[model samples]
Structures are given as C-alpha cells and as structure tokens.
Target: MGQGRGAVMAELMFWEAVRRAHDEELSNDPMVLVMGEDVGVVGGTYKATLGLYDKYGEDRVIDTPISENGFTGLGIGASFIGARPIIEIMSVNFAWLAMDQIFNTAAKVRYMSGGQLEAPVVIRSPGGTAHQLGSQHSARMEKVFMGIAGLRVVTPSNPRQAYGLLKSAVRCNDPVFINEHELMYNMKGEVPEEDYFHPLEGSEIVRPGRDVTLFGYNISVHWCLQAAELLSRHHGIEAEVIDLYALSPLDRSGIRDSVTRTHRAVIVEEAEPMVGVGAEVMAIINEECFYELDAAPVRVSALNVPIPYNHSLEKTALPDANDVVEAVRSMFGV
Candidate 1:
C-alpha cells in the first residue's frame, strides 16, 4: 500500500525496518515487550533493535542472560499472563536450547488448553550460511520450525516484509516464528511510512510469467528474481517468481494456481534439499497440480554437506542465481 495520500514512503535497510516495527509496536501496545540477549542494551546482534533500550527503558526492552532456554521459556510464560512478548533468539543455531519452550509450551498451550490459553509470543531469529559462519552457526533451520504443529512459521525477504511481518506476528494470538536471513540485515528497500500488517498466510507473486514458476523465500528470493531475468532475456523463457513467505500452513492454493498456469516449477532455497522447503513444495505440486504440469518440479538447493568455513567451499556449498537459471534451462530443454 503506497502511503495514503500525504504519507511518503522511505527507503530503509532490512534491520532498520525491523527496528522501526519493534519501536512502533512497543509504543502502541503496553503489553508488548522485547526480551533477548543484547536486545536491550546492545540493541540486538544485528542492530535490529537499535536505540530501543533507552527509549523504552530496561523494563519494556529488557535484556536477558545468554541462556536461550531460560529467557525463551520466561517470555512464553509471560505471554500466557497477558504479555505480548517478542522474544529474539540471538542465532537460530542456539534455538535448539529453547526447543522445549518453543515446541512444547508456546506452540501447544492453546490447543492443549482447549482455547482457554493463548500464546501471543513471537520468536524471531536470523539464520543462514552467511559468509562462512561455519556449519554450526550457518544453520538454515526453517524447515524444523515449519514442521511443528500449532506453530506459525514465516520468513521475510525484504525490508517491507521484514517490517510488516514482524508487526503482524506481535499481534497474532498464535505463537509465531520468524526466520530471518543472516545476510539481509543491511539490504535496502522501500517501506511504507504508516503502520501496516503483512498477512501471516499466503504467497506473493513477485514476478509474473507463463513458462515456469520459481518459488523462493528469504535470501533465495533474490536468486529467483535474478534467474528469472536471465531466463527471459537470454533464453526467451519467462519464469514466474513466487515468494513463499509463510512456510507452515503454506499457500497450497497459490502453489497450485501458479503451477497450473506455468505448467512447470522450480523451487529454490539456501538450505539442503532433503526434507526442506523445496521438497515440500515439490510434493504440493505433485499432489495438487500433477496433471497440469508439463515437466517434473525441480529444486535448486544447497549441497548435502555441512557448510564449511572456508570461503571457496562455502560458496560452492550453496546454490545461486546461475543454479536457478540452469535448472530452468533443463526444464525447458534450452
């Protein structure tokens, strides 16, 4: 939504958009609190919460100890008592320590309690193989979170989505997990000046075409867009680009609609292919649009090996725009 009449749009880096969202939501809702390591005093590991500590003070923008399980559980518990807490795990790899709180408590509270309880908790974390962060640190664990029942999973690809999605998640009654990319914090894009909420469901058609569908989210979205451009210019093959921002409760109808129109599909991701987003999307294609397809759905994903710290190996382990282009060429037999 372009700013209503007099409202002007401003360009902001992804992290800035996130900080703005946090700042606005905290101001609008007194119950809303942000808790995490360095989130208060240090303004977040990626500076996504920069300057909020002083503005909101220590109580609202409280900083916790390094214990992921302790702080995450504490936030989840507070949510049940009417606190709309935004809990940021410093890194997704560290989230393993908080699985009990996330999967068992926050996710299951509403269902297990028969709607009497609500887990209005938002867990946000940044993950990905960003510039040789190593195997442990370079974890793309969105698939793991998406698979959990009673949990809402979403990943934002740009500054606009980053701002809107976070705002929406804070207000949602169901527990929301926002998987952000490690490398996209400094990425710049236009964001609306006024407050807005991006739906926690549905896929977005970023680019329209008829030949094939390219599905991506987060960092891989840029790859799909780049590949779509090359396919159109060099090969005369128009590829549609779809952003699957919502991972859990995926837009099944959207996938069917796109594949039915294009008759071919290519799912791109920055994670390994096994049991990942690409695999799940391919399954959806087979189940819902198998008869409409002209070719087998393909996936462009990271290699099955652990992400190496060495720069060359790290680059080789991940799929890129060229990989997406090559996959599209193979589909078209170009």
Candidate 2:
C-alpha cells in the first residue's frame, strides 16, 4: 500500500496529484464524497477527478448541475451531518455565486452554534489568468477568500504540495478553500508515495539566500523562483524565495523571520496590487519586521485593471519573472 512506510516517490502532474489525494481520501473515509460539475462520468473540468467516478462509483463521486450556490450549499449542509464533501467549483469566477453559503453558513456555523456544529467542507477551484481565458474566467480571488476569519485558504505551488495539502485539508475539521492555478494543471513534480500531510499554515523557503527575500504563492511562486535564478546567475545576488501557500492566517512569524534575515523583501503576485496577496504580505512585513528592514519592501503585481482577452494585452497586464527581477533590482540599485 502507498500508506506503508518507505513507499517510493513518483512524478505526477498537478491534476494527477490532486486526483491521487481525492482517491486516497475517499478510500480512507467512507463518508467522503466528491460533488461538482462533470465530476461524475465526465470527470472534472481540469481532469482532477478523472477515473474517480468509475473507481468510487457515482454515489461517492457525484456530478452536480451548473449551480454553484446550490451544490456548494448542499456540500456544506452535508458536512454538518458528519459527511466530508469535496466541492469543486469548475471555475473560481462562479464561486461568487456561492459566497452566501461559504461565508455565512460554512464559516459561521461552528461559532453560531456554540461549537455544536462544524463545516469540514473542502472547496477547490482552478483560477488565474491562463492563456487569455478572459477576465471573467481568469479570476485570482485568493485575497477574497483569505479575508474570511473561519476558513482555511491554501494554494499549492507544485505537485508535491498539491498532493499533501489536499490530503491535509480533507482531514482538517475547518472549511478549506484550495485555490489552484489553471496554468499549472500540467506542471509535473515529484510526490512522495507514502501518506503524509502538509501543515495547514506556514510559508516554505524554496531557496535560501542572504541578499533579499522574494515572497509569492501558487503561480507567483514560480515567478519568484525564476527571478531568483536569474538574479543569482547574472547579478551575483542570492535571493531567498518563500512560498506563502497558506493565505488565510498568513504566517506572520515566518514572514518576519525571513525579512529579519534577508533585511530586504519583495513580494510577487499575479493579482492586482490593491487589496491583494502582495498587499497583505507587505502589511505583515511592515507590522512585524519593520525594524529589520535594510530597505523599503516592494511588491510586483499585475495591473489594477481587469485581465484582458487580447493575448498581448493579457500578457502585458500580468506581472512576470522579469517584473519580479526588476522590482528587486530597483531596491538594490542593480
């Protein structure tokens, strides 16, 4: 069994890692059900639920109509009665329709019921601007979900994280929102075959450096990594890259610790700067490690306008690795 000790690691794509997590969790718990559009028979929109309907059967892997509010509420209500449901919103844009159930019902049920009730529902959605998917379908709404007090929000940057984080979220009693990037579905990385769980909260230092720290999450993490590489290869600057996978309850201590070490910080994000992940990370640095800064913190983010449909416009609207490199360069006067 993959659960056994010393299980070998395997390379898997982001979607396959997510599918593995769903399959394992469904097998581990009889009450774990997956519900979403095309989740059954048709699989999932991104193939995250491929073969799950056949493996687990229609009863466990359900396909709901294209009503985000209805199915999301149904999943939340199911969780209240001891059911562990993984609800997949085909696109994060449609999640706006289910805000009432997610924010009001799932997030507040435990508090409103005096701890007598809980909503252990997991809502996973693919978002981010992917090859000119247009503004409506390419919503990067992690900031919106992270603001809610009771929900756990996480965005995995790689397949290993994609595997472990989903497993951990399934076992967690709190409501979780996994914000996946649409462009990363086919990105392959090594995942441990052994059963393991990633921490629900904390930032990961993907690269260690002494000059400056670059903070990012999900797809932005890749940008930071690429920028860090370029900075080292060409500029002789060793920059640390931190992956803020958990958005809600952002790792204040980790952010402070990294900034204290590097003494300079740059946050990279695909979302617009105003009221975004970059803004929040900058706040954390300012509030917790203001004294440790060797320079003012910087943020590299997308334009304030909506994501465009024109290929060139979309490319121009979003921030990239070059943008991150330039942000750091400005700080160092490189």
Best-matching candidate per lDDT: 1
lDDT (CA) per prediction: 0.93, 0.92
Given candidate 2, what's the lDDT at residue 141? 91
How well is each residue in 183-272 modelled by candidate 2, as lDDT tens digits? 899999988888868888998999999999999999999999999999999899999999999999899999999999999999998888
Could you report the Cα RMSD, in angstroms, for every candidate shown? Answer: 1.5, 1.8
**Sliding window of 10 residues with minimal summed lDDT for model 2:** 1-10
Model 1's alpha-carbon lDDT is: 0.93
Model 1, span 1-334: residue lDDT tens: 3222355678999999999999999999999999999998899999988999999999999899889999999999999989999999989999999999999999898889999998899999999888878889999999999989999999999998999999999998999999999899999998889987888999999999999999999999999999999999999999999999999989999999999999999999999999999999999988998999898889999999999999999999999999999999987888
Number of backbone clashes in candidate 1: 0
Model 2 residue-pair collision total: 0
